[model samples]
Target: MTRTPQSARTTTRGIPRILAAGLIVVIAAIAAALGYQSQNASSSSAPSPPSPIAPRSERPGSLGAGGAVPDGVTVFDDGYPAVANLDPDLLRALRAAATDAADDGVKFYVNSGWRSPERQNQLLREAVSKYGSEEEAARWVATADTSPHVSGDAIDIGRSNATAWLSEHGAEYGLCQIYRNEPWHYELRTNAIDHDCPHMYADPTQDPRMRQ
Candidate 1:
């Protein structure tokens, strides 16, 4: 029996179809490989977040070597009258500095410390009553937000001779006076000594409550 030419042509067409199928498979495999490689490259290129830092005081204890509070420092809780809120470390530093100052015959006392929001409001109201305006009162007594005393990180220290002494030596104890106009008010300033001294606050003006 003779095979028809048409049958031969159909067999040749089937060869091409098989070849096309193989080509499609090759293309799909290449595409899948490229997609996987792209995904891996993107993942490898992404940046990692930074690790968190531990507090300075938590390091191994070694007399100013680790983060522990300095020697000869005492922690005082003045019943919120001297400080509305005080970090334990800062309180220790203040007591240390004050004791050192006393040794030098420069005695100091904390006149004002922390104030609650309600207490601040009361102060503001009193200032308004005395000054006849909230704005004028703010110049003397800070508004709620601008008042560093509210955080318990600030204190108003007084002593006829110790003010200058404190100004000169407070940095050694991690304390610094804020607002040049308010010589009595000092706040913690060093993270190594006191972690409470963050540079930024919600309001930095003398009285943020008076802004609006």
Candidate 2:
């Protein structure tokens, strides 16, 4: 048998060592990849935390802010800020009138009542956009400072029958329409029970209160 050279033996031994080292490196890399994938899977499967509850003092607006009334909301619905936030005397008169209106087969639905200053500003902006000028917008939407709704002293009644009932008997409850142009708009005038309501303004623009 021929003897192998010393160099040949060294080369054959080195090849197996190199291949073993490469295999170990490949195994370590695969294991590391699998560990990372497992970690991500575990993280993805975990349940998320629950949402926080809104504070009790935080009230929702009909327009997603405070002091808006939804359709069909009545004076009796004190749950709404629109009804509950009204001036005490005004709310009292409204409830009294609403009770009598119900007896007459009419419901006292509140179209609009108390309004946040933000909501008033929003309405004013919308009015300006619709009528093409702030001068014209004043006829409909009042400034936040001048709007009785912002002060919870006025309410807009809904439905023709409810307004008709108010037209006929509202003075008994001291509820009076304030604007001739807006029959739905009512304000509490306690003196109206003794005397008829003060002369109606043609619109909000004509009201001296709007000037302030």
Candidate 3:
């Protein structure tokens, strides 16, 4: 027996449904693969953040609690024509020592205090011009680095007898006469860092704070 045209038409319509279902499954698989690849690429491309650095500690023997000047004392730059400046504590000690010496009939005066590096250089040049060489001038006045006056930690007292008394009793006021060769110069006996430069006669015109 022969097949009817209606039956053939029904077969064609069922084939189209099966093809559509298969196409939907293929599109879903492709979409899932693309989503997985995108997630993996994003994870691999991202960067991590860096860590922070630590701060450094302060240097030892620097001016502060254990500085050269003793506690409860402050330094002032007495506008002396010869000296550079004076530490507050050192000035207090000097005033105290001078007063004490005066009570014992020993008159005292502050001859010198701070010195600028430029003034020191001028003195050095003068010495070189008059004496002969830099070495010979250095013998009379200390080089910039060796100048205790530049540090505002030294003072030159006028009277020898008063200074002698200070040497004996100055420690009570936290003062000490540094450099045995120069009896006139006195410094604070505290724990401040010591500079190796010696004292020199500097010009009064330069800035006191700019000294070596």
Highest-scoring model, TM-score: 2
Tens-digit per-residue lDDT, 1-212, candidate 3: 97669988899989989999999999999999999999999999888667554433333222222112222222232334233246677777677766777788876655556667776666678878897976665555666666667667777776677678876677777776655556777778654224332333233223243344
For candidate 3, the TM-score is 0.47
Model 2 weakest 10-residue run by lDDT: 57-66
Q: Residue 75 of model 2: what lDDT?
A: 87
Per-prediction TM-score:
0.52, 0.70, 0.47
Kindly list the per-residue Cα lDDT of model 2 for residues 13-98, writing each as its tens digit.
99999999999999999999999999999999989988787776564433324677767788888778888889999999988888
Clashes of each: 6, 1, 14
Segments of candidate 1 deviating more than 4 angstroms: 1-84, 191-212
Q: At residue 39, what lDDT does model 2 achieve?
A: 97
In model 1, the clashing pairs are: 56-67, 57-67, 82-113, 83-114, 84-114, 85-152
Better of 1 and 2 by TM-score: 2
Q: How do all the candidates rank in terms of TM-score, highest first?
A: 2, 1, 3
C-alpha lDDT values of all predictions: 0.64, 0.89, 0.61
**Cα TM-score of candidate 1:** 0.52
